[model samples]
Target: MRFATYRHDGSTRAGVVDGDVVHALPAGTTVLDLVRAGLPAAVEAGTAALAEPEVPLADVTLLPPLQAPTVRDFVAFEEHVEGVRKAIDGVAGVPPEWYQAPTFYFTNPYALVGAHDDVAVPPNSQRFDFELEVAVVVGRDGASLSPEQAREHVFGYTVLNDWSARDLQAREMRVSLGPAKGKDSATTLGPWLVTADELEPYRDDEGFLALDMRVSVNGTEVGQDLLSNMGWPFEELISYASRGTEVRAGDVLGSGTSGNGGCLAELWGTRGEAAPPPLQPGDVVEMTVEGIGTIRNRVVAGVDLPPVAPARARPRTRKRPAAS
Candidate 1:
């Protein structure tokens, strides 16, 4: 079943999405509430909601399916890693340690926006880009879980756009530290969330989902790939994420960017100067994952801030200490 959080009649409500319509859940309920209540509960609520009044999907405003407690994005596509690395650092291949385990970085959950929202280009950024990927929402709390155990914690999936400021990212990563400000600006999630059970037909025997993934800019196709192409399956990424830590209900895990031309940086790496230019104001980006749904967002100019002050160097306070 597909679940969505939407606004109607000056109020936001959670609901089960039926074709062209949405069945509202009880008042004040949100998708996050359903996720925390567990999938069986969500199924039961959705079943009961089928009798409630149906609202036209087009009449309501969609919101992010849920406000995640935390967001962890992983680079699980080898082609994406290779292409982006080459563009950013002129590196020709993936780092050796990248294969040892699934790796991820924390992104700001508060930065999340809903499907069809407007995203502002980060201030001072000239090279804006979008990453096409799929994300999983954690439904059960677990720590130190093995791949087999992690499967039970899966809740559902959604399309994710990890918007980027390539120029800013390039500068920060040069110091070997961040994709911070470059990424923290905004992340797009939703249209709606599709339950894990709903995607059973797409799952392969090896636990990978053979779902088609695609992205476009301003109605022009930019890239496409299969979810099955991921170097590490979602289960393994979840298992690795739970290592010595905890993954709880409402936490979101992203599958990084898809392969092929997932982002302009990848195209830039392979096509050099001929690659499409970075996103600009008024550009629209759309990302879709089979079995989930599509999320479309438009770029807008950002609020420009005064120039940032450079860090001041501190005086050397420590003497030679008697040449010890």
Candidate 2:
């Protein structure tokens, strides 16, 4: 079952996406709340609640399908590294230990947006790009979990548009603070969240590893890469991420930009060069990870723009040094 958070009638409600239409769910429908209530049982309840007919997806806007109690992203692909190696300082294909451990970040939870919405370009960005990849939504709360038990904690999965502001990202990294301005503004998620049970037919040692996730600007296919191509596997990411930390139900763990070709920065090279494709106001970006779903967002001219300063993560999980 596909789930979503949405807005309609001047109010926000959550719903299950059925086919192309979304059946309105009750308000206060957060993935975390549902997970803590009892994952599989909660999903059963969300499904049962959808029995009462509601508005069609066409009639309402899909907000970020999740209100992740915690939003953490990890660098888990080798393709992305190999692609940007030459451009970045001393960086090249899967730096030795990078694949051995899952690298993660704690991003702003409030700024996340929904699919098909307009992505606001912040005042700080001159170079904006899109990253198409799959992300997992945790279903059960646990810590120190084994790889064998990890699958039980995943409620579903979805596609993500890990938009980037290249210039700001580069600057921040020099200060040993990763993606200060580089990852701000809008992180688009959703269209629908595909449940774990639904994907039983595709499970393997690499799991979703080999599935092709594609992206497009306006209407052309950029390139397609297989999830199996990842340098780090999902199981490794989940198991390692849970160490000494509480990964709650509804927390989203993003598989950082799939491969170098997954985003414009890698595909087009930085500004002083020819852009394979540069995004501007009015351009539409769409990302689709097979079995997960698609995320479509349009670029729009930003307003007066906020300060662009990064927000402090709540409760502040342990902070890792940026230089490592």
Candidate 3:
């Protein structure tokens, strides 16, 4: 079943999505509440909501399915890493450690926007881009879970757009510390969340979801890739994430950017002069993952803040006394 958080008549509420109609869940209930309730309960509640009055999907404004407790984005696609590494680090191949285990980084949860929200080009950024990804929401809490055990913790999936400011990212990563401020602007999630069970038919024998993913800008197609191409499946990513750490309900795990032109950065690495231009104000970005849904966001101009004070000059070293 598909679950969504939407605003209708000036009030925001959770609902069960059925084609173009949405059936409201009880008031005050959010998608996060349903995720924390566990799958069976969530399903039961959704089933009950289906009997209530229907609201046209177009009449309500969609919101991010849930406000995640934490967001961990993984580089699960080898092709993405290959292309991006070349462009960002001037490297040629995927790092060996990336194959040793699934690697991820934490992004700000407060920076999230709804599927159709407006995203501003982060202040001081000129090269803005969007990453096409699929994200899974955790249904329960677990720590140090094995791959087999992690499967049970998945609640659902949704489309994610990890918006980026390449210029900012490049400068910060020079210090080997962050993609911070670079990615601190906006991360889009939703349209709605599709429950895990509903996607059983799409899962392959090896546990990878054979989903088609695509991204377009201003109605022009930018890239497309298959979810099955991921170097590490969602289960493994989740398992690796739980290594000595807890993954709680509503925590989201993203399947990085897909390869075969997932984002402009990767395209620039592979296509150089032919790569499309970076996102600009008024540009619309739309991303879709086969079993989940699509998320569309528009870019807007950002207000620049005053420049921060530069770092202090290094202190002069004192001359030391000669040792005996």
Lowest lDDT 10-mer window, candidate 3?
Answer: 267-276
Q: Model 2, stretches more than 4 Å misplaced?
A: 90-92, 269-272, 304-324
Per TM-score, the best of the predicted structures is 1
- What's the best-to-worst order under lDDT? 1, 3, 2
Cα lDDT tens digits for candidate 2, 1-324: 777778888888777777777676566666556656765776786788678686777788888877776677887777776665444444544578775677888877877889898987766577778888788888878898877677777777888788877767777787877775678677888876777777666666656556678988888877578877766666667777898876777888888887746887665543335366557889898888777777789999877756656777777669876895
- Candidate 1: residue 256 lDDT (0-100): 96
**Which candidate do you rate higher for TM-score, 2 or 3?**
3
After the best TM-score superposition of candidate 2, give how far the Cα of residue 120 lies from its true spot, in angstroms: 1.8
Better of 1 and 2 by TM-score: 1
User: Worst 10-residue stretch by lDDT in candidate 2?
Assistant: 85-94
lDDT string, candidate 1, 1-324, tens digits:
999999999999999999989999999888999999999999999999999999999899899899999999999999999888888777878999888988888999999999999999998898999999899999999999988898899999999999999888998999989889889999999999999999989989888999999998999999999999999889899999999989999899999999898999998887765268999999999888888888999999999987768899988778655764
Q: Would you give me the overall lDDT of model 1?
A: 0.92
Clashes of each: 0, 6, 0
Model 1 root mean square deviation, Cα atoms: 2.8
TM-score for all predictions? 0.96, 0.87, 0.96
Best by the lDDT measure: 1
Off by more than 4 A, model 3 = 316-324
